[model samples]
Target: MTNVIFTVGNDMRADDGAGPFLAALLEADPAAGWEVIDGGASPENHTHRIRALSPKRVVIVDAADMGLAPGEVRRIDEDCVARHFLITTHAIPLNFLIDSLRETVPEIVFLGIQPREIVFMAPMTDDVRRGVAALHRTLVDGVGIDSFPGIAE
Candidate 1:
């Protein structure tokens, strides 16, 4: 089954850039089992491509204000998306986007990296960068998605 990965964030906003940074890294030398998309702030823009891919699973990576230490990575409970985190700055909300995508993708998962700072024109923090690097290695190394921390099987 095909697997798709969507990284969403605003590069202009400090740690929020983690998504695209990781996307670029994965894209440069993509792994065999996944298709990486630099979804940016408007992930909804890629709905067509996702539908076209007919993936069985979709993993979304984004920087969220999850009230955790900076660079901490965890699988956000789908039920808590709206309440506990600062989602994308796009017009469409992340929860709605995920619900809509569920029509095509059977399994949808979210990986959230806590942001140290989201100030405009700032660079990504070292903490978030390290987290991104670690995630990149796990995915590239073919670790099972079930192995992702904080995600309930």
Candidate 2:
């Protein structure tokens, strides 16, 4: 089963760039069974490609306002996604996007990293960078979704 990853964010916005930055890293040295995409701020733009991949697992990494401390990461489950309207800069709402993708992908994982500063022309915060690195490590180690830190229960 192909593993697909979609990183969504706006580089111009500080910590919001986490998705793009991580995408670049994974693209450079992608996992053995993974296809990485930099979905940028509009993940909806890449839905066609995602559908074409016919992946068994789809992982989406994005900065979210989960009311946690800066740099914290959490796995937002489908139920939470349906219940809360997250603040995103995508053309289509995240809930709808994920729901549409769910029809094709067997499993979808939404990794939400708490962003400290999301401002124009600002660099990513140190804490968030560290968090991204940790996430990258976990992916490389092939850890299960249950192993990720701050995962929603």
Candidate 3:
């Protein structure tokens, strides 16, 4: 069964670059049983590609405002996404994207990294960078998402 990670964010934005940053790391040193897709700020555009993969599981990573501290990472519940992600940079909401791929992808996970700021052309915040690094380590080590901390209620 193929497991895919779809990262969503804008590299030019500060904390919003968390997804792309992790994508780059995973691309450099990929993990077994996992495929990395840098969805950038327009993950909705990649639904066709994801459908083609017919992955067993799909993980979507993005910077979200969850009213948590900067750099905080959480496995966001699909239903709570709208409540927590009040502001989004993407053209289409993530929930819609998830729904679109649900038929092809049996399982879907949404990982959110709290952003400190999202200024255009600004570099990623140190705290968010650390979060990305932690996620990278977890993926590369094949430790599984269960070992990662935080799960939004």
Highest-lDDT candidate: 3
> In model 1, how large is the Cα lDDT of residue 118?
87
lDDT of the candidates, in the order given: 0.84, 0.81, 0.86
Q: Relative to the unseen true structure, what is the C-alpha lDDT of residue 71 in candidate 2, on a scale of 0 to 100?
A: 78
lDDT of 1 by residue, 17-132 (tens): 88999899998868778998888988889888888999999888898777778988888777676566755576688888889999989999888888898889999999999988
Candidate 3 lDDT by residue in tens digits, 1-153:
689999999989899999999999999989788898989998887778777888999998899898888888788888777666735888988888888888788899888899999999999999999989988988889898766566655
* Sliding window of 10 residues with minimal summed lDDT for model 2: 144-153
RMSD of each candidate relative to the true structure: 2.0, 1.9, 1.3
Model 3 TM-score, 2 decimals? 0.94
TM-score of every model? 0.93, 0.90, 0.94
- Of 2 and 3, the candidate ahead on TM-score is 3
Better of 1 and 2 by TM-score: 1
Index of the highest-TM-score prediction: 3
Q: Which stretches of candidate 3 lie over 4 Å from their true place?
A: none
Supply candidate 2's per-residue lDDT for 144. 49
Q: How does candidate 3 score on lDDT?
A: 0.86
Model 1 alpha-carbon drift over 4 Å, by segment:
151-153
Q: Candidate 2: where are CA atoms >4 Å away?
A: 82-85, 149-153
